[model samples]
Target: MEISFVRIDDRLIHGQVATIWTKTSKCNRIMACSDEVAKDDLRKTLLLQVAPPEIKAYVLTIDKAIDAYKNPKYDSFKTLFLFTNPKDVVRMVKAGVPIKSVNVGGMCYKEGKIQITSAVSVSEEDIDAFKTLNEKGIELELRQVASENKVSLMSRLDSLKLI
Candidate 1:
């Protein structure tokens, strides 16, 4: 239960994340929750190598990550839970990931997707998950970086108001 920061970024791991977030949050381990990446050991190795030696990188299936958090081994180390999309976030939420707040680090606005902020975008189904998490008292912050202003994802849910 030491994961303090959860971020949704489609790019997975990049230079800024391997450096900035690790330094900023003092996170020693990164648990990347993605079904696609979990099966790919080569990609996982690349991600692990990018971490600046002091940090540990773990690429896990969504289910494994949820299970891993419940293990007492994770209780000692502060981790950062990283996901590539809101769908994974929603799954983790439903599976009991024990996260309080989620920050929208990046979501590439695809065709027909509604962009709430430069950093936040939602498909119709994603909007529903956003509402679910919002109602459950999970704080959602729309920001591309730590310097960006915070915004509510609901405002972009096609005229949905303060539900």
Candidate 2:
């Protein structure tokens, strides 16, 4: 499987992702890699249901995703990998997923989370996970839509003294 794009968007498989990113990356498959979501049948079903009919979608755990990615049957697939948080991205990379860069799309505001951008908010744990990914040379970019300019997430964190 060719991972055409990797994005950390809390709202997985949303409008921008379903249309813009999928088309921009030319992905045939959309893989929402989240252990928590995979176990929730309702969320998993909902996510799959929202995917554009022309594109296939899967809600998978990190390990299952790794297995699927390595499997020969999926060798021809161009997949857009989506995660809900930075730690999952870190886990996938540490487990040998060849993720060179990640788009921080929409990490929504929550109690105790610092707002990084208008659409993104991060907690201490999130910052640590992002720091780990940055240390491993993963480029983290912040962009809502394909038409907008991508900003460096790590740089923003650094400016805010979060990392």
Find the candidate with the highest lDDT and give its number: 2
lDDT of 2 at 83: 95
- Lowest lDDT 10-mer window, candidate 1? 154-163
Best candidate, TM-score: 2
Candidate 2 residue 151 Cα shift, in angstroms, is 0.4
Candidate 2 deviant stretches above 4 angstroms: none
lDDT of 1: 0.79
lDDT of 2 by residue, 1-163 (tens): 8999999898899888998999999999999999999999999998999899999999999999988988999999999999999999988888888899999999999999999899999999999999999889989999989899999998899899886
Instruction: Compute the lDDT of residue 21 as modeled in candidate 1.
Output: 75
Candidate lDDT scores, in order, read 0.79, 0.93
Residue-level lDDT for 159 in candidate 2: 96
